[model samples]
Target: MPFLLAAALCSVLVSVLLKLARRLEVDVGQAIAWNYVVAAAASMLVFAPAPSALHAATAAWPALVGLGLLLPTIFLALAGSVRHAGIVRSDVAQRLSLLISLLAAFVLFGEPLSAAKGWGMAAGLAALTGLMWRPSKGAISGGAAGWIYPLLVFLGFGVIDVLFKRVASAGVPLGAALLAMFVLALLVSLVLQGWRLARGTARLGARSLAAGLLLGLLNFGNILCYLRAHQALPGRPALVFSGMSLGVVALGALAGMVVFRERLSRINLAGLALAVLAIVLLARG
Candidate 1:
């Protein structure tokens, strides 16, 4: 339970950090790029992954490569989402990605679609609709891309989940697989950042570096704590998953409202409520 709570806290902290990037004058791209460096190093120190598993005959190279390409790019999308949308809505949209993973389970993995899960899917879709609904008259800095970024975040996370599942099915240990992704993502991020630097678009800064280090720590803590939660309760994966999902939503909302003073429309609030319901139903199913 404690590990679960810590994991959720870490997750929300990640969102909050992204939201604060603009105000803190932190270059998010640079921060994220540096984030992978810190994360990859930490993975090596903590996980000590067996190099042999990667060379095994049944290695999930395709999935690992996919994750390598996607992780940093999706992280950029998430930063855009949080920058454009309030943290509350962004977090809810992220957690609601379970809907996509559920569909993948049914279609790709041949899992049964129970009635409760079906209804949960319906509710999840409606929640997404409600959250993305905006007043037609509003002319803010964000236009169509406001909603588009969050949708990307939603879809991107779901796909990442599927890729992780694929890797797991290939018999790779979780620690090793995670370490592999971090290292691969780090390489990808470095290349992109190097291009940016070459173009004179962005320069490496101490602030971004510091922020990235912190982000890396929190991001890794979230995963490690979540792993601990599951280990502590081996027979209750559903409980651990649900707790982490729900806790992030709840705490993220609080941080958005109380700390950031983000305002939400009635429809958005309803969407948040429905997102909670969808998670509950999906977990039970």
Candidate 2:
């Protein structure tokens, strides 16, 4: 439980860091590229070459590779979503990943679906719809790219969670699994960035580097706690993840109000209240 709580706090902090990175004029791709590099290094230091860890890591490479490939896509889509939709809306939409993974667990992994899980999923859906509902401004609205990006991000994350659980069940050491995943992701990012630099499509700057380092640290802590929580309570990853998502939203809202001075409309305020209620139900369940 404490591990899960720690994971929730770290997840919330990651969201705050992402918002801050934007204000600091950080390039999202660069930040993500560096984040995985640092995370991989940290995981290797913590878990690799300890004799006992080698066997688990050897067996986990396949799932880890799959997870690694999904990560960049998830981050790219999430960043795009945050750019198109507001941060609050993007965060709310991404929380729907929990429902996706829960369903996947039932259908694909043979996990039992209880009434409490169903209710939790319903509450999550209601909260997401409420968050996305917007009052018309009586003008031509944009197309569905914004919505599609976030939905894709949600699906990517859901797949990641399922893969993580599968690897865990297969006796893969979490730290080793994370290390492999990040290393592969880092190599891919480097290749992509190298191509961009060669084509003169992007230039690396000091601000971008610094933001990447900071995001790297935050992401490392976030994944560490998340994996620990999932390992500590394998039966309730969805519940823990829901709590973490709610914490991120609450923290994001507070940060928006304080740092961005973003005012919430009456409807948004109501949505926030429902989000809180959903969290309560999730925790109680």
All candidates: CA RMSD (Å)? 1.3, 3.6
| Candidate number achieving the greatest TM-score relative to the actual structure | 1
Output candidate 1 Cα RMSD: 1.3
Instruction: Show model 1 residue runs off by greater than 4 Å.
Output: 137-141
Instruction: Encode model 2's per-residue lDDT on 218-282: one tens digit a residue.
Output: 77777777667777778986677666777677666766567656555566667667766665555
Q: Candidate 1's error at 250, in angstroms?
A: 0.5
Q: Model 2 compared with the native: what TM-score?
A: 0.82
Runs of candidate 2 with Cα error greater than 4 angstroms are: 1-6, 20-23, 49-60, 138-146, 227-243, 263-271, 279-285
What local distance difference test score does each model get? Answer: 0.89, 0.70
Candidate 1 residue lDDT tens string, 15-127 = 99999999999999999988888888888888888988888825698999999999999999999988888788789888998888889999999999998899888999999
Location of the lowest summed lDDT over 10 successive residues in candidate 1: 133-142
| Residue 59, candidate 1: C-alpha displacement in angstroms | 3.9
